[model samples]
Target chain A: MDAGLIFYGSAIFLMVMGVFIAITGRHLIKILLGIDVFDTGLNLLIVSFGYINGGTAPIFSKYPNIFKNVVDPVPQALVLTAIVIGVAEMAMGLAIVMQIKEKFGTCNIAKLKELKW
Target chain B: MIRRLIALLVSLYLGYILYSFVYVHFPFGERPLRGVAAHYVENGIKEEGATNIVTSIVTLYRGFDTLGEVTVLFLAATGLGLILAGMKREEEEKPEPTLIMETVTKHLFPLVLLFGSYIFIHGHLTPGGGFPAGVVIATGYFMMFIAQRSFTPSEYLLSATESFAGTLYVIVGLLGLALAFSFLDNVMPLGIPNRVFSAGIIPVIYIIIGFKVGSEMTGILLHLKEA
Candidate 1:
């Protein structure tokens, strides 16, 4: 009956869907996309846990007198760094994919099993 | 088919475990703040001179983690460059951009740049900060890449800006160590909160982060473009 339950549900759904995609998808790009979805779901879960029922943002200017009602800010700070690092990691994965395509001429996981060039 | 079904089952089980674990420990939206979050919310503004507690936590309380995070990004970009090195591209005929895309990009590019600058400049006092602002600046360059036919980011400019910003970040951290209690400590005067000039070393560190992230992101985008 709680509204927060809906966010929790969505986060779980995204994580499950990402895992499904990452495990079953043959294309390298699809797997990478799954990884991204997984990261996003984890981020959502963190931010959601930091939420208070009626609390405002932790910014002092927005709610000067909301000393007792501000939501947890540690999660928000951690999520910020996580999101940016995800971008860097995903970019690196794509770069490796590009190299694989250059040498192996395929993006499918099933076809990229050769060890030697 | 069996593999897909097995994967689905396994992931569903894992997801259930994760969800239940979180639900049991903290419940959803009902838990009260404790420990560090409480401390930061109470005295973060007064001690850090920044209206945004998240900024204070990221730049002051956990500055070392942020330093490592930035280094991770830099290393990722460097590794990306190294992985894609020495691939010669045959010059292909450039295609012209659509009229609407060209017109829109031309008009939107400068606005995006200005908005990105605004976000980073007032990071200590705003909701958004260096990372989002840096990505926005890179998005502007990305627009240029798509709109212009023969356009490429200048290697010299990007490297210079990235190096300068990264070096400044280290220097600021060292200054904190030399004058204050430890590395990345807030040593400078904490001006009045809710103002642009407040939050000593917080804004400075964020600006440096902004420039470094912007230049690195732009380079990554340009590097990944098909030649």
Candidate 2:
């Protein structure tokens, strides 16, 4: 019955939807999109956890700019790093997909198992 | 399907397992997130002279990681460019499409470029930092696709920007080692806080990162275009 609980529920729901899409979708790009959705949900969860009561921005000007109430820069920083890493990973995946399309002429993963064993 | 069932069960188990951790009676779980990040942040200002803790953390504490990340982005762009360049257009050759809204974007391009540079320059003091600023720069180049539909970027220019940015990053890092103790170390007499050129290596490193990311992303976008 709290605001945080509601946000948590929404984050979980997004994760579930992402997983469902990844499992059910047949298209390669859609699968990638589903993974991105899941990543976004995870990022949301991290930032939400870092929330504090009426927190000020993490800026330190002389005189203890904020005696208290600063949410968490760590999580935000973590999310930034995670997003950049995800871009690299997704780019590599897309490159492989492009190469597969060039060779097999189709993007469906099911049809991509030309290499037996 | 068995896969779905497995996924559902795993998620349910994870939720149940982490339920106590996430929903404790207290405002937050056991501790409030300062378990490991305290040592550096406690005296970061005294050392780094940057008012923004995030900037200090990014540009000082974990600079090597930032270096590696920029390298990763550079490598991805390189691999993607090679792949796209090698791709043989299989579809039938057709007449080129006419440029759409060329005049407007042509005028807007300079403004976009200026904005990107501004963001990168003030990354240490503002909300927009290296990565986002770099993306903005790339977006400036992207505007060119709209300005001149038949036009393509001169590969040499983009590569030059990328190399120059990359070289700047390494040279800055080396300077840290040369003057200070280690690579990427923040030496050079930490200037007074909140100045444009303060945070000895922070601004320089971020500017290089900004440039590298901008050039690499622009290359990637151009590479992905339908040739």
Candidate that would win on TM-score? 1
Q: Which residue pairs does candidate 1 place in steric collision? A: none
Error of 2 at B127 (Å): 1.5
Q: What CA RMSD would you report for each candidate?
A: 1.5, 3.2
Please list the residue runs of candidate 2 whose C-alpha ends up more than 4 Å from where it truly belongs after superposition. A61-67, B1-21, B24-30, B33-36, B39-41, B90-100
Q: Which 10-residue window of candidate 2 chain A scores lowest in summed lDDT? A: A61-70
Candidate 2, clashing residue pairs?
Answer: none
Q: Write model 1 residue lDDT over B1-227, tens digit each, in one string.
A: 89888999999999999988888887878888889999999989878889999999999999999999989989988898898898656688777799898888889989999999899989998898888899999999999998977678797899899989988998999998999869999998998888889899898998898899999999999889852
lDDT of 2 at B227: 33
RMSD of 1: 1.5
Best by lDDT: 1
Q: lDDT (0-100) at residue B45 of candidate 2?
A: 70
CAPRI quality level assigned to candidate 1 from its DockQ score = medium
